[model samples]
Target: MNCTSLQELGVDSNGIGGKIPPIIGNLSSTNLSKLYLNDNEITGTIPHAIGNLPSLTDLCLDNNMLEGPIPLEIFQPGWLTQLVLANNQINGEIPKSIGLAQHLSIMDISYNGLQGTIPETLSNLTKLGYLVLDHNQLSGTIPPGLSCSMILDLSYNKLTGQIPDGVAGLSSLQIYLNLSNNLLEGPIPLEFGNMDKIQALDLSANKLSAAIPAQIKGCAEVEYVNLSRNFLQGALPSSIGALPTSLHVLDVSFNRLTGMIPQSLQASPVLQFANFSYNNFTGEVSSEGAFANLTDDSFLGNPDLCGSILGLAPCSGKHGHFLYIAIIVVVAIAAGLLAMVCVVDHDLMKTRLRLTAPSIQLSHFPTVQGNATGKKESDEHPRISYRQLVDATDGFSEVNLIGKGGYGHVYRGVLHGGTVIAIKVLHQDHAGEVIAGSFERECRVLRSIRHRNLIRVITTCSTPDFKAVVLPFMPNGSLDSLIHGPPCGGKPEGPRQLDLDLLLGIASNVAEGMAYLHHHAPVKVVHCDLKPSNVLLDGDMTAIVSDFGISKLVITGARDPEVGEASTSVCNSITRLLQGSVGYIAPEYGLGGRPSTQGDVYSFGVMLLEMISGKRPTDVISEEGHGLHDWAKKRCLQHDVDAVAERWLPRDPPSVLPFGPPRCEMEVIVVMVMELLELGVACSQLVPSMRPTMDDMAHEIACLRDGTWRKYRATGLKAIDQTKSKKY
Candidate 1:
């Protein structure tokens, strides 16, 4: 019993490459607290008798190819704290009995093929500091009793349910709480708001629901908060306005919520990256102070937002009513002149339109091309003939009509040799001088850009009486169809019912495309109108940013005041022009006569959140006093947002029951949803500059997917191992 300590036993030196000796327990001594028989090619299970060592404190059997469950005898005692059985092929769960070790502190069973739920008994270790069970096959809820306060990372696991309320209240949680890409649910606990000592909190890609708690506003000491891809709702709490000025990053995209953005958030001077896109919000936007310096891409997708940011239209109604009346009179006079010209040349105009109608079945022609000739353009650009477009569209046949917009009707057509294309014809009644200028400007911008995300302009045709722009056909249709229409109806079946993965993929791709236009394109392009309808999906579900009618292509190195003034004036006119669809139009466009990229970012954020939550941003506004973005944001702050899941998930018996026979892992799915909500919250931030660039958005989504997939695979492996071990 008083045997001396066992010297370092190098198993690899003995050439013992086969199975571990079962009788090796004889080496155990009362004073043998440290056993290091690692770095060997040894195989087979550890001996049970080794557990009889009452003095054992450190047993590191790492870097070996050992297989089978850990010896039950080793866990029976309660003294061993530093058990490092890592880097091995060991199987089975961390036994619940191991929690009996009241003295255990550093238990790292990482890099092993271990399976099963984490033992709740481990919570009894009051002295535990670093508890890392990452990269394992652990499935089930995080034990609420886990006492470690510093760093408790159960990330990259199949754990489900909300982070237990008790766990969020842990006293040692000062550094971070990384529960990204898990099956966790429920709103982030408000108790976490009191953990002001914590630095980073990442609960992204989970099924957590409700709004980010206002309590967190009290955590002024926090630096980073990521709640992306969740079911969170509501406007960001005004309390967030109280965050430490040192806060650097915040993301809450892809959720259901809405409201007028708080001015306090927009004024935050320290925010570098923030996103609140794809949600429902409506209000006038101003880019003074911290917001003015940001790019237009930051505020894409919000139709009801407007400001003076670069790459965006000027706010509408900025000019007095006299100016509006003057413009209207000018347009009326121009219309009267055009009408007289039509009357004089009626026969010729009719004949020309008829001749070209066959090529553009979906278009009415006269609206899009009629004014192109009178306008100035670079002579090098090719001019398409209206007759060819008419011939392709077969005189705007009903069958060829794909969609209708306030500006014009979109038509599908085939050219002479079978070249399939889309034709966008402007409305004839709006073909006055002002409207014609907008048409020409759109065509000019579309012609110069060539990006996979941007809708390509194949050609354009203009005449005294007709106008049209030809584009390549989009087989997968528009994002609007998927987000707003019934999936089962229509030729393309509208938009497919998307799971969390698919939603994240589409949103990320759209963001990437937008980011390219705003930041990477040779000429900075502001996609002034980035609604769901403007996002087209191709055969493989690849998204292409479309609708350049409101797009602005800024020339590089051009500081001409005339250019700036003209662009600003045109943008201001367009904002007040009532051109965009009613609900999707930015608020400032209706009142302020300004359009900024921040407005677009807000719209895009709304679209993103709407897609993930399966709610209409407009519906949230009209039916619900609050919009979807605000609702989701507020719910995230609460702990009861999971109730919204009932609306989206199948309500059948098995689906509703928590632990039914046909359980479909709905809880896990909900966690993924919450992750998405967090993304939406980020995109919908009041401060446009707080939003992440589309490139960053895409990368975050990819990271979530990778983490989720790994956890899923690990869980499946654990189940297989458990069944096999039971049979033995």
Candidate 2:
């Protein structure tokens, strides 16, 4: 513990026995990061000591007999992901405050004595995928919108009332769903038919009645199903057998079901087990295909049944084989017609979009042309699939996610060939073009412009149900993290403190990117949004401005791209969510002025001031006014520049001081901080005409980075101060 960083402590599974406690001394640290004792027989209450590890991300106490109420402190960590307290004797109702763990993707508290209704606040966990609270005393109807989960096991509970329909339609319910042995009643929701990827579904031993839903044939990937021990009556829908060739196991025993066994089940290629016992069914059951090896145990109690199988009375030709053939023919024809309609509708949609498509001419980078199959053709970066992204990011797992934006979430991924990329995946819940438009617009902007300081696209993965933009993963994350650390949980990447020289360099890089967009690119563009979170730092700490989902594209007939006005109104931007970050947004935008290059300059100025002041533009210094501008102006006049910056400064002395030679105590201050603050004030003038151009600002920062401006600091400072004195 003296020299090494204590990252993890694991003494799992019988390493400690009859335990009243595990050693608590090793848990504490000066720079302690992770401490989790998983899978051990550590007895007594769920430890209050676990509350000590704020950095703990995954706490697995699985298969233990820990007995007591789950402490309120368990869900306090903002970054906690996997919480496994399964197979324990833990009692007490789950705290309503469990919803505070927003990043939680997996929560397993099964096989316990907990009571009370499931907290509806679980819907707030957008990233939650696997939730298991089975074998509890919990009652009440299932809380809905858990459609975000791929696995939901709430079996062996006192859950009552009709099932909620909010969970059935989404593709995320692809793995396994179990809600058996409950007091659930009423017909299965019609939305269950949309579970296209589910391989296993279990809803046994319930009070459910009424007819089996026929729309369930759409479960093209179902392999195992159990619908036993219910009060369900009426004919089993033909869709049960039509549940794709993937069907391998079926159990619908112990119900009041009446009907001939579906012939589709007889022809199932992979079906290994079938149980239709204790029902009023009176049809000839075929012993062909998957049912060939089954014994009479599966059909025992059905006295009226007659089939070709071993222990049942043989049926005469009066049952009519042609009837089954006719039913199969009708089902086949209907499926074919449905697929045809889907293809036609898809083509019609493509036709409409193509008619409105803008002609793109990407001069520097390769142009990606969308083909009829919905795949884009490009050679620069390989085309990846939804599955590849799933594997790369561990099924878009919460742990790999680097940042979350309004429209999308970004995850760090390593491709098969070892190329590290940031996968910017749009949230799928948003209907229509809200998700699609963001993907298209960002690609449109990234393709048209190329700059050292601007982020580049590394191909894209797009399908009807999914879309993601691939870009190089920055080892150092966004500038927002660098300046202010994370909003919660931990410190920023790399050094905890940033020197003024590094800040100056970052500001210069941003200006260069913005200047190129406004002046040098083929299409004159307005970066409608520019802020620190959108500004990422790469491996060498080079700043890159990104996220152009709402950028204004100003294409015109002029041969010189920079000289022409926007052919379309700047307000016709793609994303309707937001123009830019509040407080950083230009004053003109709020007053209904058209977007222009001056807006970018104003944003860059605000960012520059934020870096120098170490305070966000949103921080209100006094009742009179808010923002970093007002705060810095007051600080400059009162001369407390070092005091504000010294809070974030490291132990090292200032390395890039502006004044080169020894001077008086007053002159010892870094003049660059003051000049940059003045520059921020100048460019953020309320009057758009008064703001300096990005070109001038870029040049000014570059001189500061190169230390060439130090010779003329006196004149430069005087000019900036005069510019700031105007009626802003």
Score residue 499 of candidate 1 by CA lDDT: 47
Give the per-residue lDDT digits (tens) of candidate 1, residues 142-213.
888777644466666678877877778764565456777778888888778667656567787788888878
| Window of ten residues with lowest summed lDDT in model 2 | 573-582
**True-structure lDDT of candidate 2:** 0.70
In terms of lDDT, the poorest run of 10 residues in model 1 is 364-373
Segments in model 2 whose C-alpha atoms lie over 4 Å from true places: 1-379, 558-581, 621-624, 634-650, 653-669, 708-728
Clashing pairs in 2: none
Q: Which whole-number lDDT from 0 to 100 does residue 374 have in model 2?
A: 37
Model 2 lDDT at residue 446: 83
What TM-score, to 2 decimals, does candidate 1 have? 0.45
Residue-level lDDT of model 2, residues 1-728, one tens digit each, is 35345665554432344644534433555344344444444667876666556676667676656888888877877777767777668888888778888877767787678888888877788776667787789998888866454457788899999888877665666456888889999988888888887767889999999988898787788776789999989998877888556776788999989988888887767677889999999867777777899887999788777677766566765444455446658979999999999799879977987897643222334644432133465654455677888988888898998876656778988777666779888766523454565566666678788888998876777776777887888888888888877643376685535665578778989999999998899877788778887899988888999988767766656342222223232354411212213357675443334777888888888888877766776333111223566566665635777676454333443232333332322342345666787889888754465679888989888877676444544444555455557734
